[model samples]
Target chain A: MGVASTALPRGQTVPLALRWRRLGRRLGFLCGLAVLLSPALFVFLWMLSLSLKPDVENTAFPPVFIPTSPTLDNFREVFATSPFALYGRNSFVVATAATLLSLLVGVPAGYGIAKAKAHGLAFVVLVSRMTPGLSYLIPWFMLFRALGLHNTLWALIITHLVIGLPITIWVMMGFFEDLHPELEEAALVDGGGIWAAFRDVALPLARPGMVVAAILAFIFSWNNFVFAVVLAGPDTRTLPVAVFNVLTFEQLAWGKLAAAALVVTLPVLLLTVLVQRQIVAGMTTGGMKG
Target chain B: MGMTLTSAARHPGRPARRAVASYRRRDKYIRFALPALLVVAAVIVFPWLYTLYMSVQEWQVGSDRVFVGLDNYANLLRDARFHAAVGRTLVYTVLAVTLPVVLGTVAAVFFHRDFPWRGFFRGIFVLPMMATPVAIALVWTMMFHPQLGVLNYLLSLVGLPPSLWVYAPDTVIPALVLVETWQWTPLVMLIVLGGLAAMPTEPLESAVVDGASPWRVLRDITLPLTLPFIMVAVVLRAIDALKAFDTIFAITQGGPGTASETINIYLYLQAFSFFRIGHASAVVVVFFLLIVALAVGLLLVRQRTKWA
Candidate 1:
């Protein structure tokens, strides 16, 4: 199907059989891709529709795939009943702080690891990530309470860094490893110190990695729940925990839940799709595990 | 951004002055590393040490604790709930990882072609991953409703019976795996797609020239070349699935009689809900060990496979 210019003796007309076969293959390929992409896309579209519908239509039989009379009532309820704006603010602060913290610490760490070829040091970073959040849950919960930091954004930020910093370090290590040592070497020959070389040369070259790391770090922190649930007090509760809070009842408010979920996810989704190529790049570098 | 080159003896030119420069550079390296290491020590390492200590002692929140060495671990050995959660976590990880990888690889291979709107479609596919799991899970829980849900309505439109998803005890994990696959298959797809994009095309082109079928070309070339990426997908998905808390909590809360309770869920319940801090710490240590073992195994595979 990919062979657009197959060798077919210059003067010969195309064979009907081969054209039909190619057409069939193309159709089949399109069908396959559709089947693959449908579930996620359809579900997202469904959520969107659900979020827009009146509560009467939400649970109606012969369900509303699209809202006939679309309304903002659910979104209104989402904001009115809950302190969603406050939760959003908390999430923003926590995630941003986590990202900033990751950058502050992880960049230098990546530089050292790359320059020294310290695989073990990189592994140590990975180990922090590789351990499940639950492992950190109980102790952090207890210790933070002991230290009177339990309900504070500091605790949330610090715990969130456990998720973000490793990713930043991992992705940045790969970027630094891929750098040509000659750039730094040339800077050194120019009588510039190591700091000048790194700042003027290596760091500038690593801007893409920085963006990728920051975005990935922020996204992970934004989406995090366990740490927030275990450590965050009401004042510091982030969006995921807020969303989870709305589901505490056995009987769910699907409309409000859908609204809250959409509200919680919208920012990250837009940011991701807006900078998808970098997200793709970041994920692979961080995911493929340096 | 100051990089400290530590290997001074390996440098070119004068040895004497270079030694002083190298010493300064080493110091800078240590300084650069100090902040990150300190934070990790204070946050990750300290908590881990505390968890280890807590694991050995019989304790709970708001209670005077007794020092009961190895008792928590011993209790875990005899605990049926702990065993069930561990078993369920393994099953969940396996199912969650495998289905997504397989589906995602196929999607990736299909998308690697030069089709029109491929970028648009890929973006659509990647959207699910970008969305928060809490949102996805909440939406899915609604969709999984027995009645008054669009899914069952859609199934009825196709003349099929509506099925209980994440509701029935026997089918709970499979249903949760379905959501896992929906949300994460795109991530695996993106990873494999990256690998596929970077792959050399000569073998595939040659395969095509040899009158090979598309399946043959894929089997003989694309799949083999993408094995490392697939393994990456496996390792990542396995890791994420092993520790997943939000989606499971949102959708099922490890309910329908603990049928879908993974280790993370069980640990959360033990620690926070039950306030069995010592027992939960024991679970935590065991969970950490399992993660370490899994990670080491996957890293070995990556080593053996020689992925860049």
Candidate 2:
């Protein structure tokens, strides 16, 4: 297809048979892409349809793809019956706090590691990231109770650091590694101290990286289920836990459940759509380069 | 280089003094790393040490703790459920990793070619992975419904009988893995697409000029060049798959019986559900070892395949 398009001169016309064949091939390619994309598109669309339709239509025999009369009752019902507002607040607070804290700690660490060639320290951070969350959860659960911090957002915030901090460090490490060392060195060669060099030279250049790291950290922290499920009190439930609760308590209420799920996912979904390129870049760099 | 030139030109001598000053500066910078390291140590290192400590003692909820060194580990050996969970976890991980890697590579190859609306389609493709796992799981659970599900409806439309998806023990793991594959295959595709984008086109163009078959070119050149990226995808998918908890928990909660229960589910039950902290800690230790071993092994393989 690429060859056909690029090989042809702008003023030249293709033979009739070749043009027909090209059209056929283009259609085939579109079909293939659609087939590959169907599952992903269908799943989300189906959920959306479920959330829109009435209860009867939701569980209809053939399953309704579109509601005869689309309604917002399911979403309204969700807010009425559950403390989704509180859950949203909890998720926002925890995710924001965790991201900020991870940045404050991790960015400097990443810069230091890159500048000082502290491969051993970087490896430790990587290993810590790779360690299963459950391993830490058990100990943290015990420690939290011991320290009388269980069921508090403080407990949740600290635990989420394990997720956010590693990512911030890894992403920042990659960013710092890519930076020209001479910029900081030049700053140092001047009257600037190490702190000034970092604060003035490296930090400004790393702002985009910080944004990427912060977004990723926030997303992961927001999406975290296990830590919140174990550590959160009723009043402190995050969105995932709140959604899970809807599932448990309202098993057969498919519309309400779907609505709840969509509500919980809406923020991250919006973020994903808005900054997918950054997310993909961050994920690959953080995963592969680490 | 410029800094060094200017500094040397300014000083004319005392290069040794400059090196010492730079070394001192770097030493000071290393202190900036200490806060993060200390935080990680407090959060990760301390917990791991405590887990190890707890693993040696029998500490059930609402009871005095007693030292039972190695007993929990011994029990794990003799325990059939633990064995089954381990087996299930491994099988699940293999399916989860292999399917996504294969499908993703194929998808990446397709997406690498020119097509209309390619970027838009790729964006749509990655949605499942970025969506909250619990939400995706809930949606999949609805789709996996044997009677009312769209899946069964679609299957019936194709003249096939409706089958039990996540409800039946015999078919549960694969069914659950299907959801996993659906969600994660896009991730692998994205990673491999990156590799494809970064790859040199010279070999492929030359191979085409040599009249090499497309299949032959792909097998001998493209696959080999992308093997390192695929290995990276494998390593990541394996780690995440082994520790997969959210989707499985939200979907089947380890299933109709114990069929879908992987090591993670078992560990959750042991700790939170059963409240046997010691046993769960032992499981945690074993699980951590398993992950580290696999990671080290995969990293070794990845290193060997680092041709690019």
Predicted candidate 1 versus true structure: per-residue lDDT over B86-173, tens digit per residue: 9999998989999989988888887787888777777778888878888788888888888777777888989999888778998789
Tell me the docking grade of candidate 2.
Answer: medium
Q: Write the per-residue lDDT of candidate 2 for residues A1-290, one digit (tens) a residue.
A: 24353334344556886677778867877787888899888988899999998889988898778899999999999999888999999999999999999999999999999888789988898787667787788888888999999989999999999999999999999999999765666676677788888897899899989999999999889989999999999999999999998888887799998999898887887788788778878877876765
Worst 10 contiguous positions by lDDT, candidate 2 chain A:
A1-10
Q: RMSD, each candidate, Å?
A: 3.8, 3.1
Q: On a 0 to 1 DockQ scale, where is model 2? A: 0.55
| lDDT digits (tens) for residues B2-98 of candidate 2 | 4644763564435577677767777887988999988988998999899999999999999999999999999999999999999999999999999
Candidate 1 interface RMS: 3.9
Q: Hey, what RMSD does candidate 2 come out at?
A: 3.1
Clashing pairs in 2: none
